[model samples]
Target: MHAPMPLISTMVGGLVLAFILGMLAHRVKISPLVGYLAAGIIVGPFTPGYVADLSLAPQLAELGVIMLMFGVGLHFSINDLLAVKHIAIPGAILQIAAATLLGFCLGQMLGWSLITGILFGLCLSTASTVVLLRAMEERQLITTKKGKIAIGWLVVEDLVMVLALVLFPVITEMLSKEGVSPTEILYSLIITLTKVIAFIAFMLIIGKRVIPWLLIRAARTDSDELFTLAVLAISIGIAFGAVELFDVSFALGAFFAGVILNGTEFSHRATNNTLPLRDAFAVLFFVSVGMLFNPAVILESPFALIGTLFIILLGKSIIAYGLVRFFKHSKETALTVSISLAQIGEFAFILAGLGLALGIADSKLHNLVLAGAILSISINPFLFTIADKFALSRLRKNTTLTDTTSKETAKPIDKQQPMMPFSDHIVIVGYGIIGQKLLSELNDANEEVVIVDHGKEKVRLLKMEGHHVILGDGISEEVLTLSGIAKAKWLFITLDNPYETAQIMQMTKSLASHVKIVTYGSHLDEIEYLYDQGAYEVIEVKKDIAITMASKVIPSL
Candidate 1:
């Protein structure tokens, strides 16, 4: 139990140092990302200072990644992903292939085995999602067309790495004296794919409904504490669950969790609520990445380190840029995408660790990856600033896919459709299962209904059913006005995301204070906050469930 103190110490100590340096980095007009990395180095084993617990820092760093990816998933959209699919999907595949070939050649020259070479190449291929996201978010480029392309491209890299992690062992077994068959490798790949598919399906179908429902229940309790806990629970639980049960990467799991939520009304709220936690731990993640660096690699193998750096920083960037351009995007878009991919991160360390454990990689190779990650991540922040100064607004304005730029502002829908003026109607903010249920009940009661949803599929279905539907973000004032909130008799907020729920609540009351406001809370602690936010009625979901369940179970009493 006492051993855990070191873990706590590492977290607290790492944050303190990171904060100080991060402030300094800001004062110097550089990205705080540089300062975070520097802080990690100062506390890392490579430097001559108070070293943190290396083992413990990584586990905490994982939490940071889980939160960060969840935040990304919050603002992400399926449409954004599809827009870049042409460039991102094939671009990432070929980029990884090219990088691996480069690494393989370098390993051959270094006299390492084919397996080691492949692993080496594999590490070089994928850019650090953490690094890329932090850089993109710093400049507020994540929701832009180019940002989506980079994000989609990174997703491909993550999926490939997951596949590689599954296959590494089989290949290692073959290379061993007790050789394995090709059949074994094939079978392993199949099993890995099966797990990956199962996880994705589960998240999209089951988790989508379950996670949001749980959060809605949590929100109804009106407990700010519980609502926040519920958000962390959903994000961290799904992320860790993916790794432990499905044997996938934690970031991939969390990223998908956020993406799944993105399809729901709760996305913006989830992103806003999780931001502080994500930013704090994300800093820790950078620090942890820095902790792995061994400065000795520079002196011992300057040429080798330079070669590795060249492959990661220059080679990958050019390949990514060329691929984006091949897909017919403007040079500005191509270069923006390329510069983001220039750095490698968390996934590289994971691969290196596995290779070292399998005896396919030596300590020297591990050091190279670590050193390369530190250098790229530290310098990549400046590279992004340069890209911004060079490209700035031109990149966004000049994309070949013009719709990709404009449509990102809102879900591109046909404007020819007439707005149905819903009067004396029940205006609902979300169109999830609860909202749908309430919509049905209100219809059964012969009440006029106006439903607002961010989901195109739901809007389509609602329109087909002859219901008044507004297909825009609930957070938007224009969307709210379209929903006729001021004229509506009753406003029902049924989004599972408490943050979004609270936001909409404030928006609704501000728009129509005289209109009756009824909303649900996911936690016991949320009731007061909801009241403060102008809710006329705040129903705590869990308490209601317990009361209803108790009434049925102990009626004799």
Candidate 2:
């Protein structure tokens, strides 16, 4: 294979593997990440198929990292990160410290070097944003106070992880060289900080001023490919400069580029186009990381592996839960935030790479930690189930360790919550005929009703009709918050999906335990599930339709 061709070949092979395995994973009810990891292992050097030459792949994968971080930055406004810093910064630090300490202890017990131990801990210290976001989306938790706080914490963690990546290399380069002194370390630190500060200042002061103008010019041209390429160029260019000029990691540059572009009006389009590219490369990156796993070594070090897993999954969960509690989040909110952030993610790989470059991590150690990371990501969803059960059990016994101090911390809305008598009441989850009929009935009754729909046209139509409507994902807590679920006396889930209704019901129960919940579903099983989730009444639409038809026929007869 030719130089760049081998890289292309590996990328193609990895993406195909990811797509196929990802579909299979979905069919089997597992995370697509597990499939991606499995694909990497199958096509890795240890397996029989086309071995992806990772040396070339990792370099390309760096593009993926840049784009991924860029996307993260674009969606994440600094205001949000700053607002939640209280929980995010402390939660991240404590979680990292706990995981690192546990890894060091496990490393000593396994007779590994202190460096290897630290590497293991570093890998475990980070959580996968991709996985966490997907999980939060699935659970309809993404729009909650808990979700916002959790993601904000991840943001801070990524920033800290970036800084650590920069520092590790400089320190290692100096220490590994001959005649290194304390003064050299100080100088290296100063030089690194200067580079970082200068790079950030340039991005904020310079990039921000220039990128908007550049994007507007690109948009005027109306060339999607050019615009896309422009986005990529800016991202890669900044990242490269950071690495070459400031001695910062390319990831930091990519992040800064994102932060810069985040201020621009063209951010949404930039992200939309870059997402496909990001997904393709990110899959390859995950595959490449999986290729480093030496299963034999991991199996041999069973005690260490098991111990590390506990620390990453259990210990980190505890730390996050405690921090959330200390921050005065509710029991449910604490559990929710903790469960979402229990797995290691992209920064773990970055740290592992840094450790390897610093000679702090050997092949065996890297492989061991990488393998464990994949395992954690794979099992994260299942672990959430366990977490929910544990929380429920604790809640049942009224022994939840929750943060009850922050009265300002918003709680998720609950159905069945008490409400003032005769308050305007409307519960709209969709805008279809069923919802329209319900709305009409409420209007005739002279009650206040709120419409929740993500459909743009429906929201517009509802607004034109003088109906109170909020446009957003109905399943999202933010959407519910906007809908004033906490104040509503009645909730009508007219959405067709019973699972979504169940989530809304559960989340509503946390915020308002006395509001009435009425839901409509097509299936009896779904209706039953909705009922179990605290629905005061679940009407099977199909059954009701049949009953109405029979009543009309009997009357005619």
Candidate 3:
């Protein structure tokens, strides 16, 4: 136990440090994980007296991970999962197994225990939700088919991580008991499996049926705080119940609770309301992760640090690229999806926690994992940009049937069909430069293009030019349906708000998977997120166009 007064002061100080560091990283266009890791180094044994109460930090961090997982679960609807189920589950399992084997081999070479090696591999399998999700939003690929698979893949990993969490403690407990045998282990496994099955069935089937009714009833009271509290209560309550009654992880329950509410009409409202809470607690989670690093281990074994970083970056990328391509996705799709999964995530910290508690990991190994996670996460966005460049080069070189581009596959529009139903058309969500360029190119090529803009004047102008236009915000479901988005062949989101674009794209993907989507965004980092959201193509307008012009201009001079 920690001294209360000192603990509180430590926590407050740690938070302040984390905030400042995060702000600096963001301002300098780096991942916040870099800031968090730097904070950890500064507050570690090497630095001055600002070190957080390590004992208390873990507890608070647990709460943060729990809430974070709960929020993840809430975002995952059955429909959303089902839409990308084929790739998500199998792809994740295969990736996990492959990573474990590789990690085991690497550990053997490093002279570590097999169990420790396996734990390290498991840690590598978990992709950072914060990093990947942020990247997805930036690229506006959140509605593409590739995006759906990426998110679904993450969802599967989240489930696996939670199960691992539950199993670790139980296995440790059994190992300590008298007459521990294969038979006893098998019995325990069966019992645990049964409980998990029951818990999932209750949450998805029973809870799904019950939760929306409760939310609706609460909403009728017209109290915003009440509604918000009820949302938290349900999330926290079900999560806690799973831990207490079913012997499961709180993250799993919270996630399933969100899945239940996903079917409701008020899900958007729920997401809006809960986002503030998610952001606050999420900060604590990152801060705690930052506070765990030991500079001594890193200094003692720079080789190990380098080796771990290599495995995190190169190992994951190779596996992701292979798996995504094996699923018959395009090279560009495969590359973006692969890059998104290249880093270890928040779940690694959770797994490390389990390992520490069970004494499966030594301080050196724990610090190594923490350091690797931080470094890998920090460079992830930059890595995505590199991946995209490689993918684009590959796309340009490939002339096979697998090559999917506007010029190669899409049919030209017929002059006779001027009033073609918006069905089987690409819906352009904005009329900005990228949107206009895409519209013009697609139009010239004879592909069906229907434009939607909230600017009434823009709509009128498009109409005057004999282009089909819908006047409304693309973020709204009513506007989407009215613009014939449900029937359209692709969704082209050219909006400014990365978050809104992601949400819209996700919803659009849910409605139609065959309808491939291609969108544009302001940042290269967001390309992965756009891929995860279900985009078939994510155009990084700033990087690609500017770089193209720069090359031409430089060469001419």
Candidate 4:
């Protein structure tokens, strides 16, 4: 019989074990990451029985990093990122410095060299992207202000780590007993930074145009398989190219690729399409990391492990919390951000590996870093879950103060858009660009209207402006009822979202069968479908645009 293929067997073994453990973790009310890592340790070469292919594991896991970083880029919003940069940029730098100092002190006590200590300190300074993103997702806080700040803080850390990766060799030589020249250090730093900057510039300037245009062209082929292939290609291809040409990390490359793609209209579709693959590969990534961990380190270097964990889990967290509170944010925001940064992952492992290769970190340090990472990551979710409850409880106690408070009492009244009740009026769903223009024309014609929007901020602004607005999802029946859908003379759904527009139309028909429904679709392809979904009239936006342009340029036609 032919020998079992390591690739297939490794994937199968890791996935199966991870699933069993993940399910158990779920039942016990813990992060599935705990189980995934446990699964890795079991199949890892350290534990002995049915060890997964050591060499093959990393190759599989690397895909996970590429895909996960790619997804990060996909959701990386420039506008939201900018809004929190004031705090995120400086906060991340200071917090990292604090953690490094704590680690350095601990390293010095252990009699480690300056270079080894610096490497150790750097390893503990950054949090795992996988762990933080999962925590935020579990709590559905990704779009909240707290989530935005935490993500932005992480972005800065990732950038710093990327630069550190560039300067790794220089720092190793400069800080060692056999020190290098200031000129050599400067030369290396300048060269590494130049490559990094050039990579970012190229990705933003050239990649921004090429990537979106490429996706648009691929999407026009109307092939789901091809579109998915195209996205994966861009993500992996750029990640590989960045490492080869620019001496940057593949994760950074994939991340920028996602950021550029985020600017396109097809971004949402792209996110939904590849999310499954990203998620699957992400599981592999965690499992592979687990495989490298030697559980014996717990018994082998008990004190060292504890010290590393102290710096990573407690020290770093305290620094993050204090820094956030120092900036005058509420206690809840501080706690959430603190908990988010309490663990280190991919970068720590990368640093540990590099340290081992360069003889800067001893075998003891390497294993301790792994032990610290595994334990810290496993424990992080519980910390977040506890913080979440505390914030929730505090919000309930004083709704006006805490970040997690419900909108009913916590939301400030928008003085600009005051609410007014109206009947025998049009109810417009989706206050997007088209909806806004339609409201302007109808209001000018003395046609009373009430707007329903999903965005809390938009609804607040409209309510403050005195243009009757309901701050709830248009797809919800309760929201429609609250918007006076039953009494409204007409329901005009101006949103170009065909799926949502159809659902709303169906709901409107069921609620008020006689209510007139007029809707707009961005493409003529879905016009008939919308009509079938109970729209009395469906306006085709692109077709109308084409007609208008034709009328302007060729009036006779």
Candidate 5:
């Protein structure tokens, strides 16, 4: 029998293991990221099983990072960042400085050189884009004030790391040559900043127009395959070009590419088409991280591991919390932002790998960073749960105090009937064509309807039309609650994305068991899956259209 190619074997093995473990993780009510990581460790060289090609795994993982950052860029606009800039920019920088100093101190205690310690410190200073985004997406916080700050904070961190990556070689060379002056370092910094600024300008001035025009052309071809291909090509091509021509990170390049395309009419369509690839590659990225871990680190350097975790989980979080609170944000927002950034991932790995390549950091430091990443990521969800409960308790206490004060100071007024809360209403999850039609019919029948949609413009228009609308992803619990799902008589999901549709159905079923859910699907398997997920009715859109056409023509005949 012929041997399988290295690339093929690595991809197959990694994905198969990730799926099995991811499912198990889900079954156990933990983040599937835990399972993906476990799968990596099992298939890694450290274990006595079929090891995937270590060389190729990282390359694939890089693609995952690129895709992920692109997705973030699509959702994130320059305006969103500006809104949170007062906190995100300064907060991220200060927090990074604090974390780096802590890491540097720890490295000094371990007897590492100044350069090595600096690099080590830098590795632990930044949060992983994948982990933070995943957590925010799960809680439906990506569009919220808190989510915007966290994302903005992360963007600042990523930018700093990119600059560091550019300057690492110069700094290392300076260290080697005793005659190198501070002016040389300053010049290098200026040059690097210029390149970054130039790249940004190019994207905003040229890319914003060109990328969208290309997508519009592709979309006009009326081929789903071609449109999707165009998106992938643009994302990957721009990312590659950024690295090669602009000497910037792929994540930053892809991010700008997404940002440029975010203004286009086709942004939503682009997101839907690329969602699956983004998800699949993200899984591989986590697995690739796991494969780098050596379980022996726990036993061999127990103190080192503890120190690393302490810095990542406690030191960084505390610093972030302080920074956010100092900026006059609420305790809840501070807690959420701090806890969300408690782990390090892709950028850490990149920095660590660069340190190794440059001979400034050793294997031990790399392993420590990897171990820290795995442990921190695994426990991040549990931390969020604890934080949520704590926040809830505080809110309850405040509510109770307010109620007590109201009772003590209340004066009797002319007795008046209180306004009734919205209930027994129909909730429409999307404001697309089907949603618009449903709303019109429901309004004509005198039924109360609440609209839940992610499109800002759509939600604004709906509200202007005097419709009750919650502007957020339907999958978010907060959005569902705002839509009054508990008292909703009928829930209609008009979203085109099957994954999102299923998620909405499942969340709705859990939140309001009595409400009926009706959704439309284009495929038989998707329809069946939606039914399995507790959808009351799943309309087969294509089948329905065909049947309707045939019925009309046959009647005429």
Candidate 6:
């Protein structure tokens, strides 16, 4: 009988344990990353269980890294990046330097060599892309100014790490030699930089044109399977090719691939198609990180592990916060950026592994970095919660202060008059095509309507057009209150997302039981569920469209 395949066993074991633990972690109201990491530990060599093929797990994790970076690239906005560059570039560089210095100081305390200390410092300097993005996305901060600054800061860090990875080996090799000429070292650095510049130039100049052309062609086939295949092929193939040909990291290659497709017509579709794979692989990436961690390090080098965590969670965060504050950014922005960067991830692993292979770092150092990564990633979300509470409290204090000042400065009136709230008005949750049409009809009928939307540009335009608008998620209780949902006669949700519409209906019902909720469902299955959720009317979109079209044809006949 044939023995079990290691690849199948590892994949199955990793994914199964990850799902179970991830659900448990979610149930406990913590990040699922903690669960994924715990799953890795259970099946890891350090634990007394059926250990996975460590080698194969990392290779799989690498694919996850590629996919994660590709997703980042897909959402990457050049204008957003440019908008925050004044702060991002300087803040990132200074924060990295400060973190690196902290790590190096720790290394010196540990009696490590100069080069080893620098390498260790470099590993601790950069934040994890996966962790930061997930945190930002979950909090719905991806479209905010603070989020743009954080993402831009991350892009700068990634670029610096890419250059560091290139120069690392060359510097190590030079230090290994005696009497190496400055000219030779400079020449080597120049050559490495040239290769990187060339790869970027080629991707931007040629890959941009050719990759989009290929995607368009694949899309023209009118087959979703083919389109998805083309997307995956482009991401993985370009990443693999970049490593082999240009000597760049897979993350960079896949990132540029996603960037090339970012603004294309099918970019959103491409992102949706690859999301599952990206999420799966990203979990694997975290698990692989967990496997690298040895719990024994907690006992053997307890202080060192503590120090590493300090650098990752505390030292680096303080530096980032200071840099952002120094740059004249708001306290909220500074807190968000600093806390978001309080974790080291993929690049740290890559650097640690490289150092170990080069005999520059020992297994102890490697395990310390891994332990630091696992702990930092798990604790990051909690830090964000604390930061958010603090920011909210500060906001409340400032708002109260401003209100008191305005009250004292105002001229005394004969009697204080209360502002009237909108009542007997219609609340529109979205401003899409359907929403626009409904608004037009309502306007013609001379009905009062209040608009609630999350899009900045849409809200600005609505306000400019002299419409009553509230800028926030429709399902938010605060947003609904601001829209006067409690007094509104009707709530119309024209959002394309059925789940969000259902949520809005529930929220509206809770706030204003008498308010009628009218929404649309894309599928027949959703209509009953929506109605059960307290929707007064659920228009089955496809059925309604067919009926309307048939009416037009029959009338013509």
lDDT string, candidate 5, 405-499, tens digits: 12354232211211114688889987878999999999999998888776657866765566677666687665577567888889999977667
**How much does candidate 2 score in TM-score?**
0.73
Any idea how many clashes model 1 has? 16
Tens-place lDDT per residue, model 2, 1-557, is: 44567767777787788889989988876678878877877778877768888676467557667777777777767777787888888877887788788878877787777656766777787788888888876765555567788888888777777777778777777767898889988998999899899988888788888888888888899899989988988888888888898778888888888888878888878987888887777787777777666677676777667776787778888888898999888777788777777777777876776677677777766766667777787788787777556643442343111122333543432333221222446667877788889888888888888877655578667766656776555655555665667778898888666777787788778877878999877767787778888999988788888888998869753
TM-score of each: 0.65, 0.73, 0.72, 0.71, 0.77, 0.81
The regions of model 3 sitting more than 4 angstroms off are 1-4, 44-46, 177-179, 391-557
lDDT (0-100) at residue 318 of candidate 2?
A: 88
The superposed Cα distance between candidate 6 and the true structure at residue 296, in angstroms, equals 1.9
- Model 5: lDDT equals 0.81
Tens digits of per-residue lDDT for model 6, 1-557 = 98979888887888899999999987876668778878888888999969999888668777877887788788777787798999998889988888989999999999998989988998999998778887876555666788889999998888787677667877778878899998988887888788878998999898978888999899999999999999999999999988899987787788888988886888988998888888888888778767777889899999999999999999999999899999998888899999999999878987887787678888788888988987898788789889766754553343111111133442321112211144799999888788899999999999988877666678778766767776666766656776777778998999776766787787787878999999988767788888888888888899888888898869753
Model 6, global lDDT:
0.82
**Off by more than 4 A, model 4:** 173-179, 399-557
RMSD of 2: 11.6
lDDT of candidate 1 over 1-557, digit per residue (tens): 45557877887878899999989987875557767877887888889968999887667666766776676667556575587788888999999999999989988888898889999999988887667876665544555577789988987787688678766775676558456677867776688778878999999889988988987887799886787788888878898899899986676688788888777666666676767878888888778867776778889999888999999889999988899988888786788899999988767877887787688889789889888876787788778767765652342232121121133433232222224444677888777788989998998999988887755578778766767777655655556666677787888888665666677777777877778888898766687888887888998998888888988978853
Give the per-residue lDDT digits (tens) of candidate 4, residues 188-251: 7787778888999998889988988899889999999889889889989999999899877777
lDDT of each: 0.77, 0.75, 0.75, 0.80, 0.81, 0.82
| lDDT tens digits by residue: candidate 3, 1-557 | 86568567756776677779989998877787777667656765556776666777677777787678767766765565688787778888888888777777777777877677888778877788778878876655565666777888887887788788767767767766898998998889888888889999988788877888889888999998989898889888998998898988776777777777666887878887889887767777777766777778777989888878877888877887898888887776777777888788688887887788788777777787888887787788787778655643442233122112223552333322222354678888888887898898998889877787755467667765767775545655545665666678778888777667787877676656677777766666688878777778888877877888898868753
Evaluated at residue 147, the lDDT of candidate 2 is: 75
What is candidate 3's CA lDDT for residue 549?
84
RMSD of 5: 6.6
Q: In candidate 3, how many clashes are counted?
A: 25
Judged by TM-score relative to the true structure, which candidate is superior, 4 or 6? 6
